[model samples]
Target chain A: MTHHAPTNIPTTGPDDLVVRGAHVLDPSSGLDGVMDVRISGGRIAEVSENLKGLRNIEADGLHLFPGFVDVHAHWRTPGREDEETIETGSAAAAAGGFTSVVMMPNTDPVIDRPVVVSGLVRRVEGESRVRAYVSAALHEGLKGERLTEMRLMKEAGAFCVSDDGLGTQSSGVLRNAMLYAKDSGMPVILHCEDHTLATGVVHDGAAAALAGLPGSPGSAEDVATATALVLAAETGAKVHVTHVSTALSAALVGFFKGSVPAADVTADTTPHHLTLIDELVQSLEGMYRVNPPLRPEGDRLGVGEALRDGILDFVATDHAPHASEEKYLPLEEAAPGFLGHETAFSALFTELVLGGSLTLSRLVGAMSSAPGRWVGDGAGRIEAGAPADLALVDLSEEWTVRADGLLSLSGNSPYLGRNLKGRVVGTMVGGELVQDRTGARFGSRA
Target chain B: MPARNLLTLEGTSRADLREVLDLARDYASGTVDRPLAGKIVCLAFFEASTRTAVSFELAARRAGADVISLSERGSSIQKGEGLIDTIVTLDSLGADAIVLRHPAAGAARLAALHTEAAVINAGDGRGQHPTQALLDLHALSGHLGGFDELEGRKVAVVGDVVHSRVARSIIPAFRAAGMELAIVAPQTLLPLDAGAWGLPVLPSVDDAVDWGADVLYALRLQKERMTGGSPRVPSVPEYARFYGVARRHLAGGAVVMHPGPVNRGVEVAGDVVLDASSLIPDQVASGVAVRSAVLALSMDVARSRVAA
Candidate 1:
C-alpha cells in the first residue's frame, strides 16, 4: 500500500512575490536572520538577501516563520456546523498562523468509512482556506468495537486514522487496530484515556478537591499511554498520542522514544495543558473542563519541560469548538473542550517564551517544522523548493484575547480577556494570502 | 463586607459565621418577624432531596417570603432545560433569592452569574452544602451550650467524605469555628491528596475516638458506592467495621452527628442513629433556624433589622 501526503486546496493561484527583509526563522532548515524570500508557483523559489520578484511586499519588522501545522483539531463539521464549519475552522487556524491542520474523525456520521474520508477531503478543498487534511476514524463510530477500512480510507485521501474524543478501551482492540493501521501505512492518532479511571470532570488533584468537582486522575491518561506505547513498540506501528496531559504520560513517551528507538511513537500536548493548570477550575467555569482534564501545576511544568526537551514531539491545539451554551454551564454538565486554534501561539509565546522557561526557536520548531515533518513532504520550512506556507508574526505586539474578537464560531478559549504578547499578523497558505492582518501593500508585477 | 450569598463556607469569615449563628439562635428563640415579607424566593432543585428541600421551603415560609418551588419532576428542567435557563427564568420572574440544588458542581455559581438575585447553594452535587454546614455548626454550638464552647473541639468526619458535599462544606466551616477536624475513611474514599486539607486522616472510627474526637460526624454512605462496577469499599459489612461510627466508638462522651438519611447498618449503626448521644434530630431541627437566618442575611433583611 502507498501512502500519500495530505493535500492543501488553496482557492487562489500561487503568487509571484518577494517578502523583503523579514527576520526569517525556520528551525528545521537552520535558516535564521533577516532574508528576502521569493515565492513562485506556491513554492519558495529562493531564500537570500535582496531577492527580487515580480511583486514585492515589505516585511522589515516582522518575524517570519514556517506556517504552523496542527496535527490535531476538531472542525465539528457536517453535524455541529453552528459550532464550527470547515470555512470557519480554517479561518481560525489561519488566524493562529496554522497553514496545515489535520481534522479529527469525531464528527457526525464519524469519518470512519472511505466515503466519509473522501467527502470530507472534497469539502475541505472547497471550504477550507488552509491545507486541511482528513483523519479517518480507526474504530467504527468511535465505539472501540470494530476497525474501519484503513487501507481503503488511505486510498480515499485520508492522511491518518484516529479515534480521538474517545480512547480505544481494550488493549486487544487497540493492538489489532494498530496492526491493521500499520498494514495500511496510516499513522494512528490516539486519545489515550482509560475510561474506568477517567470518571471525573476535572483533574484529580488538590484543586479539584478544593473546588468540590469530581476529579479524573492523571493515571487514566498515563495508563492508556503506557498501553499504546507498549503496543506501538510490539507492533512497530506509527502511533501519535494526542493531548498527553499527565507528566507520567509524557515521561512514558520519552521512555519509549529512548528505549524503543524503532517504535514510531510520537505525542503532543495542547497549548492549554502546557500553560494552564487544574487550579483554573477553581473558578468553576465549565470552559476549563477538557478531556484528559487540566492537570496539577507540577504536571503542567513537566509537560512544558517535556515539550522543551523534545520528550513531547510538538504542540497540537485539539482545537475543539462548541457553542456558548455548551460551555457556559456548570463544570460537570458542560462539554469538555476549549477553542484552541486562535490562542495556541500567543498563549505559548507569552507563558513560555517570555516567561524565560522556553526559547522562541524551540517554540517555533515545535509549532512548525516538528509537527510539519509528521505530516510529511518538507512542508514546514522556508527553504527553497518548499511550500510557501508561512506566517508573519509581530513578537512585540500585545493584544488581549476578547471573546467577540475570536475567529472561531465558539468563544470558549481559556485565554479570553487575558492580554497576551505576540500576534500572527499575516498567514499564507500555498503562496496565497488567506489572512493578511498586516495590511502590507504588494507592488504590481515588474 | 457581609456576603451577599452563601455559596460555600470555604472563605467565610468568623464574623460572618458568628452573625448567622447568632441570628439563628434568635430565630430559634421565637423571634418572629416578616424579614422576607413580599420577597419572591425561588427554590430550584434539579436533584432529588427530602430534608434540604423541605427545610429550605419551610424556612422561606416561616420568614414570610413568597416561595416558588421548582423541582426536576414537574419543572421545565425535566424537559432537558439547562440550569442557566431555569435560573434566568426565575430571575425574570422577580425572584429576589434563588436557592438552587443541582447535581452539577458550581451550578449555583453559574446561576448567580446570570441573575441579580442572591444565590444560596442548597446542594450542588458534591460541591458544597453551606447551609447544612452552618446548621450542623448551629446544632453543635447549641448542644455544647454556646459558640465559644466549640473552641478546640475535635470533630471526626467519617464515611464517603470524597463524595459528600456535607463534608466539603463542613470541613472548612467547622475549622473556622475553632473546631479541630480529622477525616475517617479508607484510602479509596478520601479526596486526592487529602493531606492538602491540613487535616489528619484517622485509620478507623476507633482511632478517631482515641484521638479524642468530641463529635463523630457520620456522612451518609451511598449503597451504589459498594455495589458499583468499581466498588469503593469491599462490602457494606466490611465498610461498617472500619469507617462506620458505632455506639462503642461514641462511648467516650462524644456525640454522634449525621448529615442524615443515614444507612442504618453502613456508616452508622442502627442503635447509634437514635441513641441518647445522637444529635441527628437536633441537626434536622437546626436546619430551619439556620436556613431562616441564611435567607434573611442573603436578602439583606437581617442587615436592616440589625441596624434598626
Candidate 2:
C-alpha cells in the first residue's frame, strides 16, 4: 500500500556517502550534466565525474536536483495536529523531496509571540525529520489588528511574517507591518484578498452562477495585489504575495518585479492554482474550495507564464491539511485547501514542464533555488561548500497519485487520482538519507 | 433513470419523472397501498420544515412503513452530534429509507455517501429539493391536462431565483419534460451568471405575462431582498410593483403557483394565493402522494438489491 518502494538508510549511518552516475540539475550552479556527488560531514564534499567513497549509492538514469524549499505552507502544528503534526508534515515533505519548509502561523493560538515561535523551533529540532522553519503572524491574533513583536520573532528564529489564512485587511496595519518587516530583515507573505469583494464560495464567474452560489470576483485579488504592491514599494520591504490566483494579480506582480529591487517585490503561485481552474467547482466537492479559489483558465495560464518569465518568483505548496470529516462536509461548510506538499512536484512536472508549458530548469528554479533565496538558506545549491540537500528523481517513472499512499495525516490533494511523470526516488537532507524508493538497501526490513 | 438516492433533479430522464408522477397519481387515487409496510423510514430534519416534514411522515405511515421522527431541537443533534453520526446510528437501527432536510447545501449527498439507506432529499439549503420539484411537476401536470401537454409550454419562475433550491430543481425537471423556462427576477435576486443557464430571462413579471407564460411559479421574498436587505433590491412595495404577481397579472389566464409559505404582499398578492387560478393548494396536496411514490420506488430498489 506504500507508494515508496521499500528502500531505507540505517538509523545511525555516517555522512560519508557517495552518489554515482546521475544527471545533476542544479539551478544555482547552472550544471545540468551527469556527475557524481560525494557527501561528507553534512556538506557536498565533491561534484566530479568519478567521485569515490566507502559507501557508494548507485543512481544511474536519474536526475538529481536540489531538495525543494517551500516558503508558504500550513503544517498546523501546536494545534490541529489531528490534521497534520510537525513530524508527520516534515515526513511528508521529506518524502516529496522537500528539505526545508516555512510553516504558516495560523495554528490554534496562532504563532504570534516570540515565545510561541521559539517553542515551535525547539519542537521542530527535536521531532522533525526535515528542517522546518516557522513564520510568525504579523498581527497579535491574526485579527489584522495591532502588530506583533517582529524583531523579537526574528530573534527567536522566525524567517517570515504572515497572516496567511486571514487577510491583513487594514492598509494601515499592513503598511506598518511592511515597514517593520523591512527593518527586521524578514519577508512579509501576503495572503492577498479583499474581504468586501470576497464573499463568494467559488470563483465569481460561470461556476458560481451555474451553482447559484455566491461569487468571488477576480477583482478581489487584483485590488489586494495592487494594495500590497503599493505598500511594498512604499516601505521597500521584501514582500512576497503567496498563492497569487488571478491573471490580474500575476500581471500586477509582474509589473512590480522590475519596478522595485529584485528581492523587494516577489510573488508565488501554488500547484493547484497553476493546473486547475474555476470549472472544477462545478463538482460541488470540498476539495476544490481553496482560498483565492481556483480562477479561470486564463489565470491558470497567466500564472504558468508568470513562473516561466520569472514574474512569479517561486512555487509554494500552501499544503493545508484537514481531517477528512472537515473536508468531506458540504461544499459551503468544508474548509478550504488541498494536500500539496506530497504531490506538488509530480503534478507540476507532469502537467506543466513535461507537457511543454515550462522548462525543467524553470520548474527546478521555482521549486528549489528561488524559494531557497526567499528563505536565504544554504539549502538550494549543489556546490562543494553547500549543504548536501538533494533529491534524486526518475523522470521516466510514471505513477498514479492515491490519497492512501501519502504520508500526511490528511489526503485532500487535488491530484489524488492523476497519473503523473517524474517520481522522486531518493531524498537527502544534511548528508542524511531521509527517503529511498529502491526498497533494497540499508533499513529494508519490509 | 431512477437513481438510488434522489439528491437532485438534474440529469433525471423524462421517463423517470413520468414514472414518479404516474405513481403519485395512483397513490392520490387510492389505488396503491402498503408497498413499504415492512420498511423502516427515518425522518431526520436538521432544519425547520412544515409541509415537507408532515407530508413525508404521513406518506411513510400511509404506505405502512414504521416511522421515526428526529428534529434538531429534541434529538442528539442539539447536543452537537454530527450529521454523519446520526445517519450512521439510524442505519444501524435498520432504517430502510432516510428522508433528510438540512440548512446546508449538499447535506443529502453527504449523507448518501455515509449510509446505504435509500436517501431522499426533502430540502438542502439553496442546493436542491428534488421532492418539491416533483410535487410541483405533479400539480402542474394536473393543471395543464397531463404531463404530455407540458411539452412546448412555458413556465415562468419568478422572484429570488438565486436562493431558491426549488428553482434549481424545477428548472431541470421542467426542461426534461420539454417545457421552456422563463426565469423572472430582479438582477439582484438572479444569479450573476444567469446567461449561462440558456433560459429566457424576464426582468419583471409583466414581461413574462406578455411572453404568454402558462404558469407563474412565484418564490417567497425573504424580507431581506427588500430595500435594506443584504443583496439590496428595491423596497418591498417597489418589488411588488414590478416583479410580484398581483391579481391584475392573473387576468392573463396564466396559472399562479407558489412553493407555499408565501410572502403575501411581497412576491404575490394575498388574494392571488387562493384565487381560482392558484395551484398552491394542489401543490400542497401533491406533496404527500409524490413522497409516497418516491418511498415506494426507493424501497423497491432496496428490496431488489437484497434479493439479488
Candidate 3:
C-alpha cells in the first residue's frame, strides 16, 4: 500500500497484528462473540479465542464489526476538490468506519466516460486511505438525454451507473438506460425525485408550512420511485434508489422487493432521512438543506419501519459536501448538501440501534453485508481468508459532533453540537491500522 | 418573554404577543412617546415594498430612533454584496435593530445569525410578516370592540394565501388572539401543507359570509405571478367570481380588510377600499403605532444586553 498525507499525522507500515478481547461481529458469517482476529499481508489470517500475533492491541469493552460499506458518497474529485477529494473523502470514510465507499458520479465533468472511471480507479488505488469505487453517469455528462457507453465504463472499473443529482426525466430515456444497464449488469442507482414536483427546498409539511418556504411534496419521490421501479421491472435491470426519504417510496420498494424478485430492485435510506425529521430543518441553519430534503416525522418513522421490515435494504450516507461559503448562504440561496460520511455510523448507531428503533444485528447488516453485496464487493464480513476490513467501536462513548474536530474539509452538518453515543475508536483496512483512537492519518506504504 | 428575533409566530408565546399588543395599544392611544429615543433602526428592504417599508420608517422616526433606509437596487446589495455582508456592515455601523424585508423565507433568521443587532422580519418571502400581522391585530381589535371580543370572532382570510407573507403571519397571530380563522382561496392559492395550519378551509368568500364571519381579511391577488402561463388561477374574471370579495358578500356589521397594494378589482370589489365597513386605511394607520411598539420591543433587547 502507498500513502499520501494531506494532513500532518504519523503513518505506520503494515505489520502482522491482532485485535484481542473484542466482540467480533459479522452478519454475513453469523459470528457475534468475543474473539481474537489476526491480520497479515493485507489479509485476515486467523479468527478465534486467544490468538497471538507480533503486535496486539487491547480492544476490550469494544464492539468489532466489518468495516462499513457505504454505496453513496460524493468525493467531488475530478472537480470540486476544494470541497472534497478521493484522498480526503477516503480518510473521512475511514474515520467513520467505512472501509469501502462508492463515490457518486455528480462531479463537474461527471464520471460518464471510461477515461474518467479508469483515472478515478487509479487514484483510489494510489492515494485513498480505504477502498474507493466510482459510479459512472448513466447518461453522458448526466444530461439525461443520451446514454453513456456502459460496457466501456464497466470495463474501466466503474462499479455502478447513476445520474445522481439529475433524475432522468424522459421515460424513454430511462427505459433505454435501464436496458443498457441490464445488458452490462450494472446497477442503476436512481436519485428519485420528480423535478416538477420537487419545486422547493424543504419537505411539504408542517415545517415548510410554518417556515413559509415553498414545499417539495412527498409525491416527488413517490412519482419518481414508481417510474424507476416500472423501468427496472420492465428491463429486468437491477435498480437501487438512493436516499429513499418518503414512506410511499419505501412502500413501493417494499412492494417491488416482495412481488418481483427478478427485478433486482433495492433501496438505501440515509442517516439524515432515517433519524432526523423535517422539523429539524426548520430550526437548524442552512446545514440541513439537502436535495430530496429532510422529510416529516411520518416519513422519518416510516423509513425506520421500512428498514426494520426489510423494505429498505441498507443504510448509506449520501455524503454530499459543499464549500462552507456556499452552505452559509440563506436557506433558499444556499447550495444543498452537508457533511455526512464522517458522522453517518455514529449518528445512526446512536439514534437508531441504541435508541431501540433498530437492532444491533440489523444495523450491522445494513452497513456491512447488504451494501457490500450491492456493490459486489467481497467485504463487509469477517472470516479467515476474507479481507481484513474492520472497525472497533465504543458504543457507550458520548461525544458531541463539532465542526472543528471533524476530518472532512467541509464542516456543514445538522448534527453539529449534538451529542451522540457511539464512537469509532479504530478502523483497519486491508490488514492496515489506517486510523485509531489517536485520530485519523494516512495509512501505510509497504 | 420578549422575542430574541421575531422570525415566526410559531414559537411565540401568548405573553410575548400580549406585551407587544399592549404597547401598540398605548401607541395607538398616543399615550407612549419617544420610547426608542437614542436608538438606531436600519430598514433593509431587499424586495420591493411600499406599506411595510414606509410604516417601519414612520414608526422608528416617531419613536425618536435614528433611522437608515437601505433598498436593494440603491445600495451595495446591487453591487453584489451578500445579505450577511450587508447585515454585518449595518451591525458594525451601529444599528441597534435591523428591520429586514427580503424575498427569502428565512432571510431574517439568517440575518439574525450573522449580526448582533436585533433582527425583525418586515416581510420575508412567503414567510412571516410579523409586524403586518401585529398591525392587522390592532386594526381588527379596534373594529371588533376590544381584544376581549376577539376570542369568539371569526376571520376569513381570502385570496392568495400561498404566496402571502401576511396570510402566513396572520394565521398564527389571529389564532393566538383567540379568533377562529378560516381560509377562502382557490385550491391553487393554498399551500400544499395548508392543512398544517389547522384552520378550516372554506370554499369561498360567500360561504365564509354565509357562515357569519365577522371579518373578511383579503390578501393581494398576486395575479402577475399567480396568473401567467400555467396560471394557478385560470383567469382573473374566474378567480374574482369565485374567491374575490364583493360588497354583497359583506354580511351586516361585517368588516373588510386588505394589506394594501391591493388588486382593487381582483381581491376586492371596485370602490370597496373606501367603503364604510372597509378597515384597509385603519390597517395602514395602525401600522405606525404597531411598528412603534415593535421597534421599542426589539430595541429593548439590545438595550438590556448592553446594560447587562
Please state every model's RMSD to the true fold in angstroms: 1.8, 4.8, 4.3
Among all windows of 10 consecutive residues in model 3 chain A, the one with the lowest summed lDDT is: A1-10
Assess the local accuracy of residue B307 in candidate 2 as a C-alpha lDDT between 0 and 100.
34
What would the per-residue lDDT of candidate 1 be over residues B203-304, giving only the tens digit for each residue? 999999999999999999888887766788889879999988888987779999998898998888999888889999999999999999999989889867
Write the residue-wise lDDT of candidate 2 on B1-308 in tens digits: 23377888878889989989988888888866577778899999998888789999999999889999998887887787778899999999989899999877778888988888989999887778899889999998998889998898889999888878888889999999998899998777776678867888888889998999988999988886563415557688888988889988889788998888988888889888889999999999999989988988877742342233
Better of 1 and 2 by TM-score: 1
DockQ of 2: 0.43
Per-residue lDDT of model 3, residues A1-446, tens digit only: 01111111112335668888899888889899999998876778889998877777777889999999988999889889998887788888988999888889989889989888888888877778887777899998888999998988888888789989888888899999999988887888999888878888888787777777787889988999999998888888888998998899999998888897767789999999988888866753577788889988889999999998878999989888888888886677778876787788889888888889998898999998888777654678898877778988988888999988888878888789999988888898887766776442222311
Ranking by lDDT: 1, 2, 3
TM-score (C-alpha, index-matched) for candidate 1? 0.97
Give a tens-digit lDDT track for model 1, residues A1-446.
Answer: 35444455542345668888789999899988998999888888899988877778788788999999999999998799999999999999999999999999998989999888888888887898988888999999999999999999999989999989999999999999999999998899999999999889998889888888888888888999999999999999999999998889999999999989878889999999999998899888888989979888899999999999999989999999989988888888889899988899999999999999999999999999999999986779988888889999999999999989989998989898999999998898878888887553432322
- Residue range A1-446, candidate 2, lDDT tens digits: 11111112222346668888889998788889999998887788889988778778778899999999988778888889999998789888988899888889999989999899888887877777777778899999999989999888888878789979988999999999989988887888999988877877788776776665677788888998899999898888888899998888898888877666633788899999888998987777777788989887888998899889999989999999988988887777789998888888899999999889999999998999988877765769998877788998889999998988999989888888899898988888888877887758434421
Q: Rank the candidates by TM-score, best first.
A: 1, 2, 3
- Candidate 3 docking quality: incorrect, acceptable, medium or high: medium
> Candidate 2, after superposition: displacement of residue B244 in Å?
1.7
Q: Best candidate, DockQ-wise?
A: 1
